[model samples]
Target: MARRYDPDRRTRIIDAALRVIVADGIAGLSHRSVAAEADVPLGSTTYHFGSLDELLTAALRRSNENFAQALRDSEVCAGDADGGEGASSGARLADELTRVLGEWFAGERGAIELEYELYLAALRRPALRPVAAEWTTSAVELLSTRTDPATARALVALMDGVCLQVLLTGSAFDAEYTREMLTRVVDGCA
Candidate 1:
């Protein structure tokens, strides 16, 4: 008799790969490790992903999709804010961005680490570069809804720097400081 195929197996493998990457870093990823992590047979890993690079790319894509969805759900965009009669749209945009960053720093440190790992991996893997690029594009597009392209790019860079600093120092992320910095960026754009 033929073996049954699990429809969700591919997603499970991708999610397991992310867990492995978060726990052991990108250097530690392997078909066997992912299979063990997913509790699937090794053949499943190979069958779903022809190569480790393919697997890593899929994992990064999945991570990016999840992160983007979280950002969307957080309503970080200007449209979601209740801009009162007197509230400056720019200020509201900055506040929303600061809230998003604070939530990300407070809750998604592991995912952020995985993002950085994938970013570094992309530096070496040409195919993975597009994944990183797409992530950046998505962020910039989100920001561009409230600001110009230049300011959007600058805000994205600032957010990346702040995230890295918070991650590196192992210090508590200060939302007020982030808000102040982002407000300055928004003001400069005006």
Candidate 2:
């Protein structure tokens, strides 16, 4: 058989890995499984990633962008391009953050579960710890634009806690509660 060429194989493999994780979780991941999901040869998965950790690292790196990109695309986080420089007021920041959180929670449950699963995997997999931290770093960086770095870090922690609560408890997201907590963080209040 002639050697085939596929520039998108790597990206497709990474995407497939995420889908596999979403469907079966970290325990279900294997190069063979990922290759089957990606519709690529098993060798392709090994060629791209020598181990499950490497594949997971790539998958997690990709997943981290989903929420950060959402935050980046937010109106307050992006700021007003039309000279509305003050639009990121604490109140406005809180409001936009809340809205964004609601949107995140409203997304597909599998996707949400995949993201959290990747983060939780860090508890046992040392390689994934930095990727989890990277998720926090990106969110804090996006938020720091609207508030001080300290406040931004606090807000990220707050959001993470709130999200964890909603996910673990199977409770519906409360935008009002999120808004109030975010406001307190943005305002530097205890």
Best by TM-score: 2
- Candidate 2 lDDT by residue in tens digits, 61-138: 999999999998887576534543665477688888899889988889788889989988999999999999999998
lDDT computed for candidate 2: 0.89
Candidate 1 TM-score versus the reference: 0.90
TM-score, every prediction? 0.90, 0.93
Backbone clashes for every candidate come to 0, 0
lDDT of 1: 0.84
Residue 70 alpha-carbon offset, candidate 2, angstroms = 0.2
